[model samples]
Target chain A: MDILTISLVISAIHLGVPIILPMLGGLVSERSGVMNIGLEGMMLGGALAAVAVTFITGNPWLGLLGAIVSGLLSGLILAILTVTLRGNQVVASTAINLIGAGITAALVPIIWGVDGTSPSVPKIPSMTIPGLSDLPVVGPLFSSLTAMDYGTFVLAIVVWWVLFRTDAGLRIRAVGESAESADAAGIAVVRTRFIAVMTSGAFAALGGAYLSIVTLDVFQASMTQGRGYLALAALVFGKWRVWPALAACIVFGLADAFALRSQIVGIGIPHELLLALPYVLALVALATFVGRTSAPAGVGKPFVRA
Target chain B: MTSTQSPPRRSRLDNELRAQLAVPSRLSAGGRGGTGFGTFLASLGGTSRSVTAKIVSFAVTIAVALIAALPIVYLSGSNAQVALQALIGGSWGSPQAVAETFVQTIPLLITGLAVALAFHGGIFNIGVEGQLIIGALAAGIVGATQHLPGSLLLLASLASGMIAGALWALIPALLKAYRGVHEVVTTIMMNYIAINISTFAVTTGGPFAAKTQPSATEKVPLDAQLPVITPGTRLHAGLFIAIAVIVILMWVLYRTPAGFRLRLMGANPQAAAATGISLPRTMITAMLGSGAIAGLAGAVQVLGVYGRYFDGFSPGYGYSAIAVALLGALSPVGIAAAALFFGTLDAGAVQLQAVAGISREMVSVVSGLVVAFVAAQPAIFRLLHHLQRTVLAGRTARRAAAPVLPPPINGDNDLISAGLDNKEVL
Candidate 1:
């Protein structure tokens, strides 16, 4: 294949990394009967926490840890509101996003005493498996893959296994399908839901950390830039399954990568119009195919035990 | 211990489930078994109980919001007392402050009502932000021209804005009403598209780019500008228009048959469909109406405040409108109060930054906390009901032990039977 083609493929995978992580997070949460519309908020929290920690501690790994913890806390808030308090899931999720936006905006100035963005921080180094790195045409992509890219691929398989192959998966599916029946079966429905949502937080935060520590290495306001919503559209496009959702993320990522390259390569299209491609595609996909896609029965419904 | 502990918990769970289960005795649960005052309140209007409930919910939400900001105040190392005082005094201190708050409130009130209307009809029109942008662009383009007379110019500008907003909103409305797509996702997409188009339009070398500003459209003609209400403050004629719109909305919602259909469709779609109401038609109309209102907000902002279209003119008015609608309990009167409150915070932010050493972002946190608290109203109600029942349990213990209950449950059963019998008409 041509060098340009190989380069395009590499950029697409790299772009897909952030989206794929969040899509997987959304999948786990939705599959367990909670609609995690707060993926965006969790990612924002994670991104800020990750970058802020790396800036303070000078340790990228510790930054990742901070991202995960903050993301989990954000999800826990969503879980408590939607599950325990029976708040409207959509409203609660929107609140989470606003909170994330607000806190980050306030903290940026507080921490850096500057405006709009943070100073650059430590970033994760790319690694390549020895044999894979030696391939002819695809070698560059493989050799340049960050730890995040490999972890995303491995975690996708792990999530699929845990969701489809394990007994715990059965309980989750059972509760999501019919909470009353799950409760009748002694499945501890609320507990399972809490775990699912928190796990979702962990994955989504990893995606945020990937954006900050691996891709950008700096924290900026609104840095996620609607990727969380695109991840949601992917979950819908992928019919809420792990592998298909990841594939959808790749398609979206390709669009993003193409948009980026098109601007650099002097494509005739207007830059603003080019930036709008993923959102437009998401709308088209949703309008055309969302009806055919089935969601979990208990998704978005607060399960009240009688 | 287990017996006493478990029973209260179980009873509380039952109380929580009662409303969701559509229990026949729901009204009495709110009214405390129909004391004379409870019955009077229940009979005053179909929604009177809900009105009271909304008031209580909003009060609690505000209290929670104030408390929620304390941690931030501590983190910022500012005096909590001074910060709180500044927040209140800055928003409402002087005549100038009040006028500035109204300046912010005018556009917000219109958008908030726009959102509340769509939500009332079970449509989540999250594209208000996008619609507003397109509306503002239309208004700006029209207002910049000098082809028409004074009144005509103003009318044309505002009409163009409304038309543009409706057209922009129509895409998601059509998809949602006919294609069974979720409006939330579709509208979010539209917002990005609107932002892109608006940005492109105002950028250098773009169609509407100002020769002077380079990044904004030319200023609107003087004739098309909304008249100022105060000499020095930013207050304008848009406040009167917003008030007029609110009155009209209230009249339409309560006095017109169309409004009843909208509310009925929202509350129970199955009943609405069975009664021959077309879901698609109602949804489309609601969306269009919502779009027009949102469009007016944009036009008002441009004509009254900016006099031109600039890139990123809105500070997420559309997103903030959702919280406004919720905090206001989706009522016109409630929305006015809520908008004024938010307007105060928005206008006061500048002063707040100067005096209290707090960021304007605190208002966003406070608004978000209000939404969180308001959305949890049902849980609060459940807990309140549990407490009320527990307090009354001892006095009515022997009477409650009897199988037959008093008038409230029996009256509710009768009412439920009547409702079920004529469910189709309802």
Candidate 2:
């Protein structure tokens, strides 16, 4: 293939990382019977935390850690509201989104003494595969892959294995399918859901970190920019499975990459229209596949013990 | 019960439980004419008590929100007292400040009502933001180009806005009603699409772009603008329109059979469906109604405040409207009050920043906290109930002697019973 084709393919993989991570996160949470629409908020929180920590400590790894920690905290809040308090999942998630946006926007100025965008922070360096670097056209693509890009693929496999293969995974799917049956089977429903949701937060935060630390090297207010929602769309598109979801994310990523490059490619379409491509695709996907792809039966319903 | 039967069966059980708990007293009163007036008075008393409880709930939510914001305020290195003073003084300090606050209140109030209306019908219309944008674009285009008489032009612009908004909402409404697609995701996606469409419309060389201005439409004609009702303030005729909408909405929701059907659908979809109410029809109507109100909010903004549609003119009024609707407990009067409070906070943000060295986003934090608290209100009520059981032990006799209150119309009991039936089904 030509350089342009190879580069486009590589860029699609890179752009897909953020969406892949959060889609996996949402997949896990939903599988355990909790709908997490707050992925957007968690991603934003993680992005801000990554930027702030990298700026403060001058270490990209520490920044990634900060992002994970912030995500876990957000997850904890969600678990408390949806699990313990039995609140409306949608309303609670909306609050989480608001808090995430508000707190991040408010703290940005205090931390960096700036509005909107934070200063550039230390970035995680990309690693080249030794043998792959020596190959022909496709080598450059593998050569420039970041830790996150590889981790995303590896994590998807791991999540799939854990969710489908393990005893714990059985418990999670059981709880999600029917919380009462799972409870009767002696699985700790609340605890499983809590852990799944928190895990989702951590994964989603990593996605946010990929944006700030791995890709951009800086944080901007509301940087996630509905990528989290796209992740959700991808999750639905994938029908809540691992590999299918990964493919869906890559497709979305390809659309995003194409949109970004369309202006430079001098496509006749307006840039705004190009930018709207992924969302429009998501809408179509939702419209086409909604009832066909069943969500977890117990999702979005707060568990209240009799 | 089998897995496939869970939702419908559970909802039926919920209705049965509600009927058992709430119908007996009313039925007893109906059977006894001599005691009917006394029961009516008792029901009235119960309503007043519930109202008091609702007020307490709102107060608790605000209190929790302020407390949650305290840490953020301190971390930002701002004095709490100074922030408080700035917040109050800026929003209500002068006649001008009050006017500005009212101006802010207009869109929020209208959008809040829109959200509340949809939410009341079990629709989560998160796309209000997008609907408002489309409404503003339509209103802006008409107001700028139309050459009709003054009143006619204004009416035309507003009507165009409502039409655009309802049309924008039509896709989601149909998808939801027919395909059972969740409106939350679809509506949010629509929001992005709307934003892109609006940006395209007003871009440098796009259709609605002004000759001189960049990324904005031409100035709206004076004939289409909402006249300022107060001579010394920015308060426009839109305020009266908003009030009229509210009054009309309240009447529709409480006094009309159509409203009763809508409420029944929201509170108990299965039951409503069983009663031969067209679920899809009501869902479509509710969403369209909501979108229209959201559009009217946008039209008012353009006609009263901006005089034209500017790209990215809204500072998240639609998103904040969710909080306003919830905080107001979804009542028309309550929504107005909540909008006023939010309007004050929005208007105060500038002064808070200038005087207290705090970011205006602090308002968002407070609003988020308020929403969180509202979402967790059941927990709060549970806690309050526990405290009352323990602390007000001596009042148990009086409570027992009191008449039984009607079942809560908000569907919380439905959720509880639904949860209970899950076990039985399993």
lDDT of 2 by residue, B1-426 (tens): 122433654445434434432333323321111122222112112112245555766677777898899887787788789889998999999999999899989999999999988876668899999999999999999988888998899999999999999988888999877776678878888899999999999998899999998888999888679999878988898999899889988877655666666765655455456678898899899899999999999999999988999999998888999999888877787789889989999999989889887898987888888888776765655565455545455465557745233233333343332322211100
Best-matching candidate per DockQ: 2
Every candidate's fraction of true contacts kept comes to 0.55, 0.63
lDDT of candidate 2 over A1-306, digit per residue (tens): 988888888889888999999999999999998889899889999999998998989999999899999999999999999899766778888898889889999998898888889999889998988998879888888788888888889999999999999999999999988788899989999999999999999999899989999889888888887888888888877778899778878988898899888878878999887788888988898788666547777777666665
List chain A TM-scores, every candidate, in order.
0.97, 0.98
Model 1 residue B425 CA deviation (Å) reads 26
Q: How well is each residue in A140-250 modelled by candidate 1, as lDDT tens digits?
A: 887888888888999999989998999998898888777788999999989998999888888888888888899888888778877888898899888888887888789
Interface RMSD after interface superposition, model 2: 8.6
Tell me the tens digit of each residue's lDDT in model 1 across B286-392: 88889989999999999999888878889888887877877886778888988987898888887777887777888788878887776566566557645655655
Instruction: Flag regions of model 1 displaced more than 4 Å.
Output: B1-46, B50-53, B398-426
TM-score of each: 0.90, 0.90
Place model 1 in a CAPRI quality band. medium
